[model samples]
Target: MTYVSVQTQIYSPQGWDLSDIYKSFDEPKFEQDLTGLQQKVAEFQHHYRGQVSQLTPEEMARCLQQLEVLSEQYSYLDTFANLVFCANTRSSEAKQFFNDTKLALTRIYNQLLFFNLELQDLDTTQFDELQASSALQQYNHYLNRIAQFRPHRLPEEAERTRNRDMLTGRFAFVQLYSVHRGEQDYEPVATPDDKQVETPAQLEALLFHSDGDVRYEAYCSLHQEMERHNGLYGFILNAICQDHRIESQMRGYPSTFHKQLLAADVPESVFRLIMDGVSDRIDLFQRYYQLKGQAIGQKIRTCDLNTPWTADDPLLKLDYKTGVQTLLNALKPFDVFYANRASDFFSKRWVDTKVRPGKASGVFSFPTFAKHSYLSLCYTEDYHSLFTLAHQVGRGLQFSRTRDRQTYFNTQPPLLLREVASIFNKLLLFDYLLKEAADDPLRKQAVLTRMLEDQFNLLFYQSTISRLELALHERAAQGSFDHSFVNEQWLEFYRQLCGDAVEVLPEHQYDWAGMSHIFTQPFSSYQYAAASIVSLACYQQYQAVGKDFIPSYFDFLAAGSSMNPVEALRQTVGVDLEDPATVNGAFYYVEGLIDQLQAML
Candidate 1:
């Protein structure tokens, strides 16, 4: 079940093809689509405004069909504008055009939201009758999900006013943070030989450099900028958290974290189970860090987490082509369809792999919804970027296929479900690399080390952050929130999770303001951690059953929204997330990797 190498390793920097989305911003078709969108909005408001609740099932079905089409149109326009602007944040035209496009789209959204607003207002008898209608068979799950949020829906006037204010409220701060940080010049204190100043992604790449000095310099430079603007970022964090608190209070949610769990479509019981299960076994994490610290004769500080512990090798410096080949080969064991789909991403220019100025620092899978997904990464000649490519492509492949098979309404799942493909891909690739590493000790050590590091990051780091987020939100809910309070909570969580082997100080406390999740996106960290743990359980199942599990895995992914995630996992992997034992599965997986690394060392 191994793939033949597509070609020998080759190196070349290539850009993604945006033509599949649009030729350019000035393309006539984009303008025509925009005009059509305006007309459709007006028509919907004209026809379905007051009588939405009384529409026949057949007419409701027609409206649903029309809504899907309009959604696809909005997806295209929004994705295109975002991709264009992210490619060059410095471009004045791009900046202005992106802002304008967002405004237009928002207006359309406000105009058409009345349909769903009224639709969701249907009483139980009305909703039951509508659900029993044959025409709504395909939209059953979507409508049911909309109904599920009945408890959280605000009054129309309150919601509309909040929505109107949000454009200039939280979003304004988010945009300011992005542009303000993006516009700063990174003057590398260590690498003076380089011709031009490096982007944040490039400097981050250096943090993984084999040289300790380079890693230290990059780490210091990154925090210096972050610390310089800590107050503004802290203010943004406070404002966002306060706003979320107010919403939760108005919605009758017990806590902000409770609201987050609902949004993720998971029960609060499972969330607490996962968080507690991880923290209860922090002893293993502490032991791993302690032994590693002893081996390297250095304390495992937060800054040094990304630094390479073992000796450097040529395998670490994989050019983009070789990295692509590795990822393609790694995915082969899944089956030809899965592997070929991934390979096509490389062949079809679906990835933007170059690290250039003004491009965003992180990696992401652009959600084009109906058309296809595109990947963006600031790749350096390192396997970190390669793993990132594999991760993003995994998500892209899933999104592209899911959209093709699903209605527009069901194309995107909750955060937990959406992350499954990407995390599972990385786990598969890691297993493949581990098996391949048997031929070389250095490679084996590096792969094992990387796996352990991922456990720290995905499991421990995320869990700690999520726990701290709970405290932050709760304190804000009680009206005792402040910048100093934020710092104290952060450092306390750091102490709890990092163990005695790692140092935590006041300096590390302020970095919470820099984390985009707690600031811009509240309570999303636990989902990332959950995805990692669930993927580990999934991979372990594959190890137990061999290739027979592939069909079930594929079926689980293809289930789309037909099955709830809890049911999907129960059917496919035989693990119940509500049970605390699932975290033990992740623990078992990591412990085995730790034993191997210790034996090698």
Candidate 2:
């Protein structure tokens, strides 16, 4: 089961082929596209810079079409640079190329700032006329979304300055944190034969080790390294919050979180409702942890949260090919087309699963509107890896559908809806695994425990982090704070969530510094909690309606940003986020799972 032994096997993990994006960074086509994008941006600015307010509906449609084309070209270059850099963050060449591309794209974005600024200048009657026109129907969603920012829009020069400043300001700090994290080598776990963990992914995998001491050491090693750089991490986080607060005030947002809500196209009340719902269910979350501790015959410590249910539990292992087949088989029974769409990621070599040095930690599906999205993973050939693959493939499928059905302007879904498909896929995979282990009590129990752990991670854990983020923002508004302040706030939130069910270790304070999302995507963790609730609700509908639910589910995925997330969920799945019962229903599903787990005990 050693990583090295697994690597030596015949079916060694595969890395994705970037040939579809570009054969190489310096390829002729890449250079041509770079130059072509610059030319197009110039032409676009020249033609439509000041004419948006005067354009007729047909002309407005034409302008948007041109902008879409420009966006596709820009995405191609930008996505390529990012994918390359993420693959090997330690590569100096990759870093330089990524920064260079960002600079070029920022300049282009600055050049085109006038388009939106001028659009915001249109009189209400003119704007209403354009929206009511048939010719501009396709861009109705895009136009409305842009209009939502009208009150917050700055002057053209100010907007351009903000765009350019981001490269050196907030964006630089984010990059620094990513590189600093990716380049670290954690101290080896002694009980685990002194194996050196080179990346965060490897250290994370160790948390699931059967040996309790090994898990604890790995956890300490991770937090200790993070604590070592707490000062830098704290500074980056503070700067990001300050920047957000300053910009929010200048834009006249009612609150710091207002801008994020507007971007998500979600109402503040909906977010608060979801957060409150999860907060009310902390007892259920803690009860599950207590049950987990009983099953494992020990008090659950923070490090042991992901540990195996028993020392002798049969660890579910699957090679990459078998894992793919398992996922495809589970998906095929749900929908042949869905299975085939996921299969394309494998058959087309669009997935990178190799665990290698310098590769980015964790898994993500990098998306591009102009091309098929690519998935990255550090697969370890375990059930966790299989589930990770399923989660990411779900993202790939959702993006695939969006790319097929929506225009570039509407391709990216809001953050709240982004995880629906992925979480649904995990739920489906969980059911399939549980069914496969029906005859073996231990195996079935293992599967059930894994699902419960995932639920808590998504629902309770993310909710806690989201609350901590809000607290950090609130504190930042009052004055500046360092890593010690962050630690105290995180510990407080952690204690509130876990209660007496699990021990909150001192090292847990440093855990906040390791969450990339807090720094990279502020105020986003609640979306995971909210999406989990929505996904569980979707799963309940699927179970009740059986195959009849497929069409609407597909429609939900394909809706993209064309519709509001709340409206889309209500229309497609009959789940209303505005209703408290929706959240209650999702937790009831969790309660059923806990009841089943209790019976097994």
Candidate 3:
């Protein structure tokens, strides 16, 4: 059998032709970027550093405009190089180039470090005076964000010292932790068919196999393999926890996660609601799993939980082109502008969809304004993969529409609102599949089963992750950073959620080891649970208003980070996040879906 190289097909469609972001790594534009950034940084230092408070609003506006332009160019270079490196980590040339570019960007960026610190010192009278200027008024949101840092702002020399210390001291510990995890090799088990596949993805595929013996062995062997490095992993966890504790105290945060929620503009109460709501709804998710167990003809265990409800049809091959087309059709109901952007995404090669070695495991669309608005799936052509495509594109579309209106500083919305568009895409696809599933009832039920399981994974598993993060931070505050303790905490929660419906074996307990998100973004998982609820409400509006809902939806997409999440969402969807009703409505919808699924059963 000839092995087809999926690597060649992973390139962006039009490749460099679509954007000047990088015509080629060898292009003179990169050098131009280096020179241009240096000039901009010098100009920024001259304009803002110690002189910002004295400048008129008009001057500040000009400074911010220049900064925006510089940021766009700088971001394009960084985003493109990062994308290239993401596609192939083995490409030393790309890796080295990215490192060089990043170092250069950081050097340039450090000059503007005083921008926020100085802005924070500006009095309300100065801010009100600045707001009166037409050019500066567009950036009120950005200005307000900087102003909020007043309490945390340190003196200029101290800030620089802290930055230098972080570079040399803080990151070094994280790197050691990463190197230890990277070197820990968990040996793979032999499959029932006697094929050897060693990677995490392949191992996951086996654990989800229809064959119970195969799944059990893969699950047990994998966890047993992980147990060998428990001590080292424990050290890594403690180090990470300690890192957060030190920073939180220095930043004057109440706890480690306090800063994250404050950054997201969400309250701790809202975070608690996500955990409580999902916990109460565990029965609904458990029932779905039990139904999946019946469909797969297996004794449901943590290991066997991933078995496909609908068996693969030998005659059917889900190709890349077909997958893209399915997403196109499912998303067709949106407005013409939205549809056009989606079409451009595929036809212009705006999406990077093929899976390959050294690539990131999960799908996400980056919201860069100048480059690819959304970098999407490493497509596997599986059913779940299709939904991922839809979901990520939804996020990209939101960015594409909104980027034109919002300046760079305002584009990074709170994480809570950031997930709204992505989850909406998922709900849209789920609704479509449930309606148009192949005419056989069993087949339809099978599709629903898959969708429901996917929901549970997002709602329950991810919420569990969020809860674990919450607890981890609490421990970090107490100066306790034990990995084994964290693992035990996870297992206890797993048992609580699964109840007696599924058995989580001791060997299966190291499941947290594989979570890439925990290391990348702290306390980020709960947003998914909130997003699910928000999307359900948004979908309800879509059902009620029909296509008439398109404009406000577009408006929401276009708003970007212009307003606070709650205010922005209210401006678009007219819902209040602080209200218990808004969250309860989401739980109620999940309960209702479970009722529908149960009746079908």
Candidate 4:
């Protein structure tokens, strides 16, 4: 089996232009906005404080509109500072500006905190009347979302104290972890031609290197560096977990997971069902690994899990331009609007694809309420990089639509639905590749293998991490634990997930320390798994309905947080996250792919 790389003039990817947001921290507009936001917050506090419940429906609508404007102003400042810092984590100027912006926002948030508390305390009749009022119809969904948090609402003073404390608590530690990780360097992989892999994204790219030895060395290099700061990373994660647990207890939430569920407006039973469904499908995950091992003619190891099955063949590398074109072409057939939205990310330079010193690792599409979203990734010129671009572009496109269609309050989607567009784009790319292969058996097999491996990763690997997080929170609830405890728990979960299909290397225990989500966004892994399931179901619908599915899919992305995620899914894609059939169907789809791969073998 052989494949041709996408041929184009190879050019170094460009950094995103932040000028659209603000030319720099020194920009007059940036400073003006910062001052303007503080003034807005103060005005809002003065006008709405302690009077939210007493306002007529018309007045309430006006207050809500004012709050939305204030939020957009604050997010604009915060997003700029954070994006600049992310582009250069080592810059003291950037870090200081980011911290300063956060401090200012924190103060503003404290002043505005009373508004939400007051609204949460609104009497039922008034709240219902406001929802029914013509003037407040646009904000009815926003009001309902706030109402859901009433039971968890702390006293005004307590909530204000907590908001202020987060600057030095959870948020501070997360920033530390991000900075520390950005600074660590990994030993160069000699087998990979003496390449120095500094950023985590570079090291991760090496995991998919065609050479098994290169993959192993890269894996060791990553974990060894993480192991060096195991204590620090562990402490950060523990502190985060402890913080969440404490907050949950104080808020009268039953558990940390329960709090996450409430924030997503998802039921605990739904999350549990997804977790249990993935757990029950461990055999399918193991089978895929075993098949990969057989295909490569060697027993799989933790490092080799990402190794290309066609190890002896030269890897297919696509330049940034070609990658963008490939994604555009794939998406054009589905919907021109989506394709055009994705193209804007590249043509408009909204993506930072350059790998350089002090830049953060990992890929992300960050959407701003006041401006277009920005994406960042270390593009390595491989198929993986191409797919990652599609994934992030999917997110950018989804958010772009929401920003255009929904208000600032409804712009961000729930965690469970957040990954749907991204995963759906990946599937679209997969189908395009498979179609391009046509009658070429080897090409079809390669595409099938990559898609299957990704599914296994999203479903099983992510679920395993989610389980480890659950265990960590439970331990944190019991008492204090150190880095060693985290390492042990990670190893246990890894072994349980891998079974005998792959050898669990010693360094694998420290792998969890390298995962940013565990430190920054706990329980987010479950969302990845849940989104994968929902995405597969959506993909199946797309396959069944062809072009008819495109509009509804777009609607799903545009829905944002305006409605319950469960209802949104049911309405847009007809996917019911609570249905066992949906979970089973996703697994069955994976099984069919596996069978196809096995037949090819």
Clashes of each: 0, 0, 1, 0
Local distance difference test, each candidate: 0.77, 0.86, 0.70, 0.85
Q: Which stretches of candidate 4 lie over 4 Å from their true place?
A: 1-10, 191-196, 312-315
- The digit string of per-residue lDDT tens for model 2 on 1-601 reads 1111111112556878899889888789987898888998998899887778889899888888889999988888988998899889999999999999999999988988899889889988898898899998878888898889999999888999999999999899999988888888778665446556656666777788898888888899999898999888998899988888888888999666787889778888988998899988999989988988987888899999999887877654567778888888788778877887787787677888888778876677788885788999888767788889888999988998888889999898887788989999999998888889989999898898899889999988998998988888888778888888898999999999999999999899999888888888887888888899999999988889899999999999988888889998998888899899998898999999999989988
Question: For model 4, how does the per-residue alpha-carbon lDDT over 425-484 read when each residue is reduced to its tens digit?
Answer: 999999999999878877788788889888888999888998898899999899888999
Q: How would you order the candidates by lDDT, starting with the best?
A: 2, 4, 1, 3
lDDT of 1 by residue, 1-601 (tens): 4544444333665677888889998899988999999998799789888887888888899999989898888989989998888787778888888888888888888887787788888888888888889998878877887888788888777777777777778777777776676676776655545533357887777766766667667766777777777777777777777877887888888888888777777887778888888888788788888877787678877666766766464346778777888887788777666887777666777778877777755666777765678888878878888778878887887776666667888776776766778888988888899899889988888887777887678888888889888888877887746677777788888888776888664468777755767766778888877888888888888888889988777766665675567886788667678777787888888888888788988
Better of 1 and 4 by lDDT: 4
Cα RMSD, each candidate: 2.6, 3.9, 4.9, 3.5
Q: How far is 103's C-alpha from truth in model 1 (Å)?
A: 1.0
Error of 3 at 111 (Å): 0.7
Reference-based TM-score, model 4: 0.96
Query: Could you tell me the lDDT of residue 407 within candidate 1?
Result: 85
Pairwise lDDT winner, candidates 2 and 3: 2
Question: How good is model 1 by TM-score?
Answer: 0.94
Against the true structure, candidate 2 reaches a TM-score of 0.96
